[model samples]
Target: MHMIQVVFMTVMVFFVIVTIHEWGHFYFAKRAGILVREFAIGFGPKLFSIKRGETRYTLRLVPAGGFVRMAGEDPELVEVQTGQTVAVRVKDGVVTRIYLDRLDERSNVVRGEVETIDIERKLKLALNADGVIESFDIHPQALMISKGKETQIAPLDRQFGSKTVGQRALAIVAGPVMNFILAFALFAAYFQMAGVPMENPDKLLIGDIVAGMPASKADIKVGDVIDSINGIKIGADSEKMIGIISKSVNVPLTFTVIRDGKPLTSKITPKKDPDTGVGKLGISAAIPSRPVSFGETFTYAGKAMKNMTILIFGGFKKILIGDFKMDDLGGPLRTAQVTSQIAEQGFTQLTSWVAVLSLYLGIFNLLPVPALDGSRLLFLGLEAVRGRPVDPNRESMVHFIGFAMLMLLMLAVTYNDILRLVRGEH
Candidate 1:
């Protein structure tokens, strides 16, 4: 049952995280008039899809990943300039409009019209007479969304990038916030299941044996339940058991075992394993688990969240400094294995890990590198400083580069994860 719970939790968590991530993009893009071509809830082949307006909302077979496809400055579009916009020159009363150069979707040429019978004269009058050039050289689309055919806008500003900077940034950040929310809710349910475990501390006890010397020759299991050792009753308390085992370490100790309730006597010398230099038997014993208080559980949950974030950042720093190999990272298989182990330990442990994962999701997404909330935040700060927005083309280019970097990073991490799983990292 615990194993089943582990599998279920792992699958559910992946699905929830992916769904929430994509939803962030979908929500903000919709409100910002950004046309979404496809809003997917997972990766791989589509399991099911429904077309709504211009968007095809899809649920894929693999629930570990998802994406929101939006438009603007996509590399997939190609076009030719028609030479519609040109530069206007005015000296005295005569005005002259001349074609400077033809530019396309990505072209930096500014286009607009000025109504003046004597355009040249008007420029001198406006420039020399007024001596004030307010809003000159300003590009309307500089701060606006780069909307075009390649942008995948089914209608107009329906692509993800078409939204305002604030909208886009918020959309990107929503995914991680949802993950934290899910984590909090999962743990809130876990705090309810606390009690004494079924097995008592005394009945489940540990016994030791020597290596291949004498006890090993008798084929003694490390965790064999000894009815009595050194003619002293054990299992009544840990102190008595420890005393008996300590005194008979190197000597031939009589161990009475009640195997299947049958009285049996065995004599064996206990020795440490030469390889590990630690007293041990061929096997290990399952010790009783200690129950914790509600306060302890809450504290553990918060600490677990902090620890996970620290571990993630520390690992990232190590990798950045070339001190840690990418193999330290894990993908779905490792996550599933970990999830299962946590579930086996108890609900609190599992939920605590979930909270940790949530923290990871939030922190990683906020990094101010291209295709992340942080990068958008950087632009926002710049706009605030400059009192205006940046060129749309340049902003889009930076984001494109960032997206490429992120994809490469994800691919590398996934490869590392596969390797860790195949090699049994734990």
Candidate 2:
């Protein structure tokens, strides 16, 4: 049951984050008049799909990621050879529809053998009808039918490459921008619910107790003021209490707290952390906080997000300097495990986790690595500097290789996560 809950929450979180990211690209592409072929959630075989206008929205089997497919972003060949018979629906001497299947039942269909075709540029089609070679212009909104599937033929004006460099760059960067916006909104929501923490270094009040930890097992509750430990007069001195507890690993100590205007005593043994080799009570000191006005929440949330950004960038710097370990990297499995642990803490903590994940997604996508939005933006920058864009075939190959490497890295990280889980390590 626990595993099921973890999987469900992971999917829900990924769906919301990825859908919003893809919607960003979809919106800008439509604004730029670029033809978006599909806005799909997940990968692999489709579970459900519906076509609305030019874009087909699909839900697939995998819930890990999603994409927005823009026309002319990929190489698509409309293979219509000479001497191949096809049926067409004509309107005002222009071809409105072309059917490659032989089971066409529509009336007023013109059957002919293809003589010449140019769907991308001139949109002209020459057909050999009977003994006469007749040419007709294809409509800009023309549809092509093959094996019962219908798709609009994209012309040069509606292709991604045909747009201005500025428009293309905006369309590519919009996804990451949306992710940052989502993160900010989530952080604001969290602040509204939990309020901003106020510094109270001198006090020794319990703010929260970790579930199943020593403090929780000892029946320690939030709002309890620690009066002393092992009969020491440690009133209001949080640092002194911490020093005494850290040195008493695996040793039972008497803790006296002021609760409900009366003194209560409990015995707790601090657990030794394997990584830090230090005793931990798994309880946080209470920093007094008061509810803020409605407008103040946004101010605190912004500051919190800024701090998180700085911390994330610092971690990246450590990794670049070879000060970080590969084992510290977490993939999808590790993320799910951590998310499940946070979910047990209640909704406020879950929202905070979601916000952090959103920020990570936004910043990671902006890295100048091939197969990411940053790489596309880099290509656009180069195009602006030069007179023409880079060769499409070469760019595609680089992105493909980068994508393979990323997949390999994901697999390695997932293996580590599984190993850690099996060994009962966090």
Quick one: best lDDT, which candidate? 2
lDDT of 2 at 331: 85
The pairs that clash in candidate 2 are: none
**Candidate 2, residue 58: CA error in Å?**
2.3
Task: Estimate every model's Cα lDDT from 0 to 1.
Answer: 0.57, 0.86
- Stretches of candidate 2 above 4 Å error? 1-7, 91-94, 103-108, 199-205, 221-236, 254-265, 272-279
Q: Which 10-residue span in candidate 1 carries the lowest summed lDDT?
A: 117-126
Candidate 1: lDDT of 239?
58
Tens-digit per-residue lDDT, 125-146, candidate 1: 1122133321232211112122
Compared with the true structure, the alpha-carbon lDDT of candidate 1 equals: 0.57
